[model samples]
Target: MNASVLPYREESLCFGPESRLIATLTLPGDHPDSALPAALTGSAELPPPHPHLHQASRTSAHPAAAGRAPQRRPPGLILLNAGMLPRIGPHRLNVELARTAAAQGVSAIRFDLPGLGDSGFTSSRLSHDEQTRAAIEDAMTLLSRTKHAPDRFLIAGLCSGADAGFQMARDDSRIVGLYMMEPYYFPNRFSNMFRTLRRLREYGMRRSVIRILQKSRFTRRHDPAADSAPVPQAAPEEGVRAAPTPQHFAEDLRSLLGRGVQIKLIYANTLMGHWDMRHHHRHIFSKLGHAPHFDVELVPHTDHVFTRVEARRHLIRGMAAWLRRIETQQHASAA
Candidate 1:
């Protein structure tokens, strides 16, 4: 029997001052002339811009544009480095995702930030945070040129990468959608209670008690908790940052939603507790799903990086499906 195959064209991208920044661009293989994507064919109609989304006059820092129909060009996808991981991402999830997207007629790029992977730091004297954003901006410029001016693009990231994507989306109008894995989880009293009860149900009192103690000890020793990313210099990939207070995180999310960004937040049961947005956030919003622009998903038995094959497959499928849905909705809105 022959092995199954997926088609794509992959190339290395080296940009920025001294060309120190490195990235991989994965473009879809040749499409049948008869079945080119709408972006290529110039068939998608541009919808009227949302007044609240972006002003025609000025540019500044803020989340992505309001949920506006994308331009004639299909949205380019930027797969950010997961935490300090290189472009390959945890378990090569970024590679797999880029391939999947290429097969679906989307272009995807995975790159490393300065001090991570093969990418060297820029010569600029900007602060660390400022440099990171500047590097990303350079990537957008280069990627836009390669893809020939995509009207907008999507940013998908995990952990620290998720944070980078979120910040850039807020500042750049070209970012139209975000897929964040294990992003900013703020548990409340009810969520804490639910977790305790869930632990009891799963392990029973005796084992659950032992497990809790063991986990506490484990966290103290190795400390993989979401809030505490180890600070050792050698292990860059282990880095992560805790989000700001729940109030601020909530406000950020709402602002992005109002701007018409389509956000998909996925939480996993890694060391970071099984936090579902429904449990942690439903109380905050009148009805969590009432917002049409965003959705939250909770996945079980998946580690933070999705090491397990089936778990990772599920994650990829959900992402691809969400991307398709967003495009479909944009087309519908334009119609």
Candidate 2:
């Protein structure tokens, strides 16, 4: 909310075996206790130093070691790639969010997953979910070496990245919160109807009705000959199918809430294919209405990728507000 400017520093970091990942760490230079190791400076061309450098720098820059009382480390925030768009996010959204968050005392990292952006491909034969979890763990390990030594973290992502963050939070206890933007979800009947009406209103009723009638006819007239000719056995479906049913997703959310993990689900108005508005979530996941830790926010007049300038500004403000609220709540609980 304050327009005050805070100085910050940025450094490129490489992690994982042979330094496979290329990540950028941003710290609030105004914070006396916030300092990064020299080895993490510059670009991926600079090979990471020994593990001892992490420990030595962490110890020397720690507030307690400097004769001051140990300060509680703010929860680190990690921004993952939205689909394959890279860590900068659509229209450099992640970069702006990280810089704004840094000014509020929240250190942030934006990184590419293996084979995305500037990061190297992962040689592991594991599934995508496994690879995502490993990538997040490596990022956490790197963050732990900083002067803050943040014990807890928040992971934010859009679309596929949001899916990865949700799965990771489900598996790892260190992940305290999740910011999911336009995450994949199955549309319920009410959601479907709402989307239809919204489209009709936006595209003019006559055109929408014509399109819907045409689509219905196409679906009903599926080639009878092709249907009868498909005697060959088909291979089993590979790769993850659509996300679980709404009930199952609700169960997962309940489990996370039981673990005291906070979650924020943001839906762009333009994301009518999956979700349209707040009630869509309530309609899909009835139990979510009772979960205080889970929240759903709707950003009106914004596309899924948030490319417009006003949309980007609204997103950044929403993110900053959420981070500040969570940080304050955590500090209060600790006190």
TM-score for all predictions? 0.72, 0.75
- Model 1 lDDT tens row, 1-335: 11112255677757766677788877665534212433343222222212321111123222434685555666788988886688999988999888777667777778888878989977788876787787777666665655334557888898888888998888788888999987876666677677678678878999987877877855565535755865547444344465677666677777888888889888887533544554566544443347877887777787778888987898789877987888798788877
* Cα deviation of 118, candidate 1, in Å: 1.0
Show where candidate 2 strays beyond 4 Å.
Answer: 1-6, 31-70, 190-241, 271-286, 289-292
Error of 1 at 221 (Å): 19
Model 2 C-alpha lDDT per residue in residues 286-307, reported as the tens digit of each score: 6755666678777787787987
Instruction: Look at candidate 1 and give me any clashing residue pairs.
Output: 62-170, 62-171, 63-170, 66-259, 67-260
Worst 10 residues of 2 by lDDT: 54-63
Off by over 4 Å in 1: 1-6, 33-71, 189-240, 271-279, 283-289
Best lDDT among the predictions, by candidate number: 2
